[model samples]
Target: MIHLEFNSESENEGIARVLAATYMMKFDPTMEEMADVKTAVSEAVTNCIVHGYEDDQGKIFMDISNEGSVLKIVIEDFGVGIPDVKQAMEPMYTTKPDEERTGMGFSFMEAFMDKIEVSSESGKGTRVIMEKKVTGK
Candidate 1:
C-alpha cells in the first residue's frame, strides 16, 4: 500500500501524476492505460479542489495500492458533499453552469476505470473509489 496526501490544487495534481507514473512502471501498464489513470486521477482531484471544497483549502487523501490483480484508488475529501448523486452523474449535468463545469468528471471515471463508487452526504463529505485492472502489453 502506498499513501499520499495532496492539497486540493492544480499544482498538487503533479504529485498525483507522478504517483501514477511510478505505479504504471511498477505494474508495467500500457501507455494507453497510464494515460487513463492520469486523466482519471486529474478528474478526481479536480473535483476535490473545485466542488468538494468549493475551491478552498482542503486535504485530499489518496490511497493507491495493488489489490492482487487490480489497481485501486480511493480519494476522500472532507467538504461539501453531493446531494443528488444521480443528477451529478448524468452527462452534461452541471450544478454550476455559470462556472462552466462540464459535469463529466464522474462519467470520465466511470468510462476510464473498471469500477467506480461514490458515497456522499450533504454537509458531511464525499469519497470516490475507483478500480482498474493493470495488464502489461
Candidate 2:
C-alpha cells in the first residue's frame, strides 16, 4: 500500500494520476488498464479540487494497494463534503454549471473502474474508493 497527500489544486490532479500509474507498474497493466486507472484517478482528484475544496485549498489524501489482480484506490478530502452523493453521481448533474462542467466525472470513473464506492458527509469530508482488476497481469 502507498499513501499520498497533496494540496487540492488543479495542477496536482496530474500528479495524482501519474502517481497512480507509476504505482500500478508492478502489476504490468496493459495500455487499456493503465489508461482506465489514470483516468479514474484524474476524475477523483479533480473532484477533490473543484467540488470538495471549491476554490479553497485543502488536503487530498490517496491510498493505493493491490492484492492479487485487484487494484484499489481511495481518494479523500477534508473540505466541504457532498450534500447529496446520489444526485452528484447522476450524469450531467453538476453544481458548477457556469464553469461548463460536464458533470461526467463520476460516470467516467464508474465506466473505467470495476467498482466504485463514494461516501461523504455535509461537513466532515468525502471519500471515493475505486477498484479495478488488471487482467493484463
Candidate 3:
C-alpha cells in the first residue's frame, strides 16, 4: 500500500500520475494498463485542483493498494464539495463551461478504470475511489 498527501496544485497532478505508475511497475503491468492507470490518476488529481479547490489551496490525499490483481485507489480533497455528484459525472456536463472544460474528467476515469465510486458533501469534501484489474502480473 502507498499513501500520498500533497497540495492541490496543478503540477502535483503529474507527480501523482508518475508516482502511481512507478508504484505499479512492480506488478509488471502492460503498457496499456500503465497508461490507463496514469490517465485515471491524472483526471482525479486534476479534479481536486481545478474543481475541488477552485483556486484555493488544500491537501489532496491518495491511497493506493493492490489485492491480487486488483489495484485500488482512493483520492480525497477537503475543499468545496460537489453539490450533485450524479450531475457532475454526466458526460459534457461542466460547471465551468466558460473555461472550456469539457466535463469529461469523470467519463475518462470511468473509461480507464474498471470501477469508480464518488461521494461528496456540499460543504465538506469529495472522495473518489477507483479500482482496476492489472492482468500483466
Candidate 4:
C-alpha cells in the first residue's frame, strides 16, 4: 500500500498528485493508462481542496493499494462535505465555477476509474474511493 498526506491547499495539490501517480506506478500500469490515472488522480486532489475544502485550511489523505485484480484509491479530506452527492457528481455541476472550476473533476474520475464510491456529511468531511482493474502492459 502507498500512503500520502498533504495540506489541503491548492498550490500543494500538484505535488500530492505527482506523488500519487509515482506510487501508483508500482502496479506496472501501461503508459496510456498511467496518463489517464495521473490526470484523474490530480483532479481528485484538486477536488479535495477546491470543492471539499472550499479553499480553506484542511488536510487530505490518500491511500493506494491493490488486491488481486483490483487497484483501489481512497482520497479523504477533512473539510466541508457535500450535502447532496447526486448533485455533486453530475456533469457540469460545480459549487464554485466562479473560482474557475471546470466542473468536470468528478466526471473525469468516473470516466477514468472503473468504479467510484463516495461518502460525505455536511460540515464533517468527504471521502472518495475509486477502484480499477490492473491489466499491466
Candidate 5:
C-alpha cells in the first residue's frame, strides 16, 4: 500500500492521476485500462478539491493498495462533507452550479472503477473508496 497526502488544490488532481497510473503500470494493464484508472483517480481527487474543501484550505489523503489483480484507492478530506451522499453520486448533481461543474465526477468514477464506496459526515469530512480489477498481466 502506498499513501499520499497533499494540499487540496486543483493542481494536485494531475498528480493523483499520474501516481495512480504509475502504480498500476506494474499490473501491466492495457492502455484502455490505464486510461480508466487515471480518469477514476482524477475524478476522486477533483471531488476532494472542489466539493470537499469548497475552495477552502485543507489536506487530501489518498491511499493506494495493490492486491494481485485488484487496486483499491481511498481518497479522503477533512473538510465540509456531503449532506446527501446518494444525491451527490447521481449524475448532473452539482452543488456549485455557478462554477460550471458538469456534476459528472462521481458518474465517471463509477463507470471506470469496478466498485465505489462513499462515506461522509456533514461537518467532518468525506471519504471515497474505489476498487478496480485489472486483467492481462
Candidate 6:
C-alpha cells in the first residue's frame, strides 16, 4: 500500500501518474497495462486540479493498494465537491464548456479500469475510487 498527497497543480498530475505507475510495478503489468493505469491516474489528478480546486491551490490525496491480482486506487480532493456526481460522469458533460473541456476524465477512467466509484457532496469534496485487475501476474 502507498499513500500520496500533493498540491493540485497541473505538473503534479504527471508526478502522480509516474508514482502510480511505479507502485504498479510490483504487479508486473505489461507496457499497455501500465499505460492504461497511468492515463487513468492522470485523468483523476487532472480533475482534482482543474475542477475540484479550480486551480486555486488545493490538495489531492491518493491511496493505492494491491491484493491478489487486483489493484485499488483512490483519489480524493477537499475542494468544492460535485453537486451532481452522476451528471458529472456522463460523457460530454463538462461545467467548463468554454474551456474546451471534453469532460471525458471519468469516462477514460471507467474505460481503463475494471471498476470506478465516485462519491461527492456539494461544498464538501469528491472521491474517485478505481480498481483494475492485472492478469498473468
Per-candidate count of clashing residue pairs (backbone under 3 Å): 0, 0, 0, 0, 0, 0
**Per-residue lDDT of 89 in model 6:** 95
CA error at residue 105 for candidate 3, angstroms: 0.4
- Position 40, candidate 5: lDDT: 90
> Per-residue lDDT for 43-127 in model 5, tens only?
8888888888885989999999978889999999998999999999999999888987999999999999999999999999999
By the TM-score metric, which is better: model 2 or model 4? Answer: 2
lDDT winner, 1 or 3: 3
Clashes of 3: 0
Clashing residue pairs, backbone N/CA/C < 3 A, model 5: none
| Candidate 3 vs candidate 4, lDDT winner | 3
Q: What is the lDDT of candidate 6?
A: 0.91
Least accurate 10 contiguous residues by lDDT in model 3: 18-27
TM-score of 4: 0.90
lDDT of 3 by residue, 62-133 (tens): 999999889999999999999999999999999999996999999999999999999999879999999998
Per-residue lDDT for 1-137 in model 4, tens only? 87878787777767766776676676787886777777777888888877777747888999988888577889899788899999999999988878778788889999988998989999888999988886877
Structure candidate 2, residue pairs in collision: none
TM-score of each: 0.94, 0.97, 0.97, 0.90, 0.96, 0.96
Which TM-score value belongs to model 2? 0.97
CA-lDDT, candidates in order: 0.86, 0.93, 0.94, 0.82, 0.91, 0.91
For residues 71-112, write the lDDT of model 2, one tens digit per residue. Answer: 999999998999999999999989899996999999999999
Task: Find the 10 residues in a row with the least total lDDT in model 4.
Answer: 16-25
Clashes of 6: 0
